[model samples]
Target: MKKFTVLELLSLELKEHNDLDLKCIAGRKGLARKIEVPNVNRPGLALSGFFESFAYNRIQIFGRGEHAYLKKLEKEKKSENIKKIFTFDIPCAIFTHNLMPTKDFLDAAEEAGCAVLQTSLPSANFTARILRVLNDIFAAREVVHGVLIEVFGIGVLLTGESGVGKSETALELIERGHRLVADDAVEIRCVGGNYLMGMGANKMLGHHMEIRGLGIINITHLFGVGSIRDEKRIELVVNLEIWDSNKQYDRLGAQKKTKEILGVRLPCVDIPIKPGRNIPILIETAAMNERLKQLGVHSSREFNEQVMRWLESENVRNIYFHNNSI
Candidate 1:
């Protein structure tokens, strides 16, 4: 079930009272009810008496002073304004600081269809705590259009415009034994110490990908159970673009690329796609290369070093031969 937040439950308007716990009591709200706050500590104020004036349809009481004062206000038969304000159609009243509603307050609440509850926490503290909890629980959930797949045990998130062949490339990767995490729309969240995790949306879960002219085909169904993944930790990002012949590409692999999500940095690679270039093979190679780096092996750098050493050795030999001939 979806989570509910405390901020989502609070009443629209609030009236401050002397009891600090009263703020905590304000946190208790229902979709159908209102809350009544009594000014027990400050009986001298005319505005304080106005609470008994509203419709007490649903009320809950907390705190002993509020309980006792409500009875006194009822016995004295407060003014019409006070009656209108206090006689609210409230559903529940929460008592803070372990204060219990008086018998008179209970009787009035019962007659008015109000419920009362008590709380031990200070009002301000409770409200603050509940607000934070609600913020996390009630945050909106939406689908982010992107492709996410697990490559070489590293979660890679691919982002680009529509019809960029993201799904097709992902399908190829799946066929090559890489796991498909999500297609079309991936829902990503930051969890476990700032690491981004991704999963398929409920509607798109376990669904096959669609490539232009290729029609719809399921990855797991076509490639067996080894092809699909339930979830994956996003560790890298790959952005695909239409190949430009005039643009210079990084042939030396010296350029370090990364992307930031939710304040966490992820390794990134930009692969330009065009005719005759196997994008899937390149992606696989990139993934494997990343694994090698993690395991302390750098193929490109090592190969470059080997070539440099060979050139140096040949230069030394040529100089010796020239000296001997001279």
Candidate 2:
């Protein structure tokens, strides 16, 4: 993880609901201060003259209550605790609901070189949004060589050796009304330690494909905007390899296989590629099958169980007939 500074947070180009709507109010020099943690602390206790377990490293959030309390304190000319709170190495202070801190607080923050930011969003909403943004920034991530596509509403990652027709198959899938998440290098991150989310490594190069003979092509322009997605939760992985005649493949599908990335395991399938084999169709079917598995419909296991039941019934009838005849 690289250094995430307060300036970077301010410069984030989030839109609409996810936007923080933040602007610097004071201490511009401390914009380069590193935000060490993803959490925020409300300095109500510390503002009330108690600093026994004050979390000074976290970004301090001054909501309406904290702001009003500061007003009350300033009315009585009590500036000791306000000055004392800034004595520690705090990352920054954010006043939510467009609330502005008093002059004493701002002066104390400026003197301590602590950045002060203001947002129009209420305290709860801003807290939720910032926490989500921070969690994504600090999540475990990995980059793998593959094409990520969304087939039948399932996120599928295509992985194989170079020249395995991954991009081509993805192109076909896109033509078939499926959406492409990324091409070539897919950046995968483990979100919430339960699911994997994948997207393009670079946003500027989004929805672009580099074919062997086609050079570079834009999927959004060629297929339209509906064919491209910014990101998706990776639900399945398909490994396409050259068809090996000598290699035994899992025809029954009873043996489940998975691939681990960033501490999260995803359902995996190995599709053997050969001349005249429709790789895109195979991948699409794999995606649908994965969806079925998620719905508790294990086709292979159910088929195997049914076969065992039939065999047991045939053996029981045979033994009874033999005993009666004897």
Candidate 3:
């Protein structure tokens, strides 16, 4: 239950949604209004005096059709419907395509303490873009310390203790042409209750990484833009740790381990760190294997089944040979 104020929504730093061009036209007093829902309402039926199930909590959008109806009602001296529409505790009113509400409508909004917003984008475009922004704002989020990278189109998160060399392995992956999503602190958000999206906690330091001895280096500047990505959907979680000679590790990939974040279970793999071992290549293979699993091809399970079938055939062959000789 994240509360996003109308003022903060206005000053969103999303670069892709610059076309919204939103500004407060009137009723600045209601800028503190709370926007709870991620969706917006057209209010066409409500403006026509049909108030059944009106979503009062959502931001009301006045598109081209709604704007025309408002102007017609103003001209016909029918201000009762306009007054009725503002009776609810609406968060704000937005007019798209630079369409301005009539004097009567604006006055109704002002009297009811509703913020009126204007956007230069067309009605459909504005509606689509604003919905996307609100969806991200309302998504469930949590921060984790890790390095996220995209290898062979799969998002892999490398996480471990303080001196586990996650950043160093990420640097090697970038050198191999993999894209780096985030370093150090990764902000993860659960999108649509199904997926986890990971990105850098700070946009300013997104492309920068810190190695133990070398300090900080910029991946984008060093490897060009192709080696960096803004964010990625984390599909696998690989935990790296120091090699323990006394402990036995899973060699057949039969042990299925998962780490849950925001209620989504991500496949987990533990890689032991030892001198002379290629961790970056192991991570890349893990990513590719995950992609194959998603396509309904489980190499480990298939191998296990093949081995079982071979043993059964060998037993049958030995029994037949003994019976024929007898």
Candidate 4:
């Protein structure tokens, strides 16, 4: 089910004023209805204002208000007389705060085809809660642009310029048994805390291969089942860019990099693309190495330490040999 945002619900236009009037106006005065009361409410000036704003009529007011007082009010309105007040049609009513209505009010509302429901909250609080919930129910949804790929059991987002070879690298990764979530355009949504998901556009889902020479081809039909994945959790980002010989690249994997998307931070790596350079192999290696690092193995750092230890031992051995020879 699509969740509506709070803003959307509040923006809806009010149509009617009171249940009876609304029913008469909508030509549904004879139909049974259901209505809910969120709090123990009093049918007075403040309530009248709220009812007017809601534009919905709830005649069987059920709440903590006294039944005898309501019966008296009904008597004042003339036993069978309806005010011809305009309101939106409501079928049922509920009394909250365990407030029961006078027998006359209940009978009158039943004759008018309206049911009432009473909730446990106070009227003021209930009104606020209802308004808030409605607001979220009616907002517009939007999509974003990015790339989502499944690499090493993690959602790896690859983002860069138009021709950064993201697709090509992704294709290579797929061939290496990894999965592809989305290419070129990715739909990113914040599902919740520290989590953002990427999905493919319907038109482009499962359709693949836009390489310079090969226009476009379907991935599932061609590569079979392993080439595509429905979805994956995003764990890292590999941004591809043209290699700059003048610019220094990180030889050691110690410099931590991250890219922020939708206010969430994701680990990021900048891979330079150049002619004759195998980006596919590099990306594959990066994914595997990322998995290793997650498992507490830092290959580059460990290798560096090993080299330093070997050098230290070699120096000591040479000194001993020279001393013995002298």
The collision pairs in model 2 are: none
Q: What's the distance in Å from true for residue 290, model 3?
A: 1.0
Error of 4 at 101 (Å): 18
Least well predicted 10-residue stretch by lDDT in candidate 2: 132-141
The models' CA-based lDDT, in order, is: 0.63, 0.92, 0.92, 0.59
Off by over 4 Å in 2: none
* RMSD to native, candidate 1: 11.3
Clash count of each predicted structure: 40, 0, 0, 35
Task: Give Cα distance to truth, residue 103, candidate 1, Å.
Answer: 19
| lDDT at residue 130 of model 2 (Cα atoms) | 93
- For candidate 4, write residues 175-196 as lDDT tens digits: 7777777766776655434666
RMSD of each: 11.3, 1.2, 1.9, 11.0
TM-scores vs. true structure, each candidate: 0.54, 0.97, 0.93, 0.54
Predicted structure 3, TM vs. truth = 0.93
How accurate locally is residue 59 in candidate 4, as Cα lDDT from 0 to 100?
A: 33
> lDDT of model 1 at residue 141?
40
What C-alpha root-mean-square deviation, in Å, does candidate 2 show against the real structure? 1.2
**Residue-by-residue lDDT tens digits, candidate 3, 215-321:** 99989899999999998999999999999999899999989999999999999999999999999999999999999999999999999999999999999999999
Off by over 4 Å in 3: none
> How displaced is residue 298 in candidate 3, in Å?
1.4
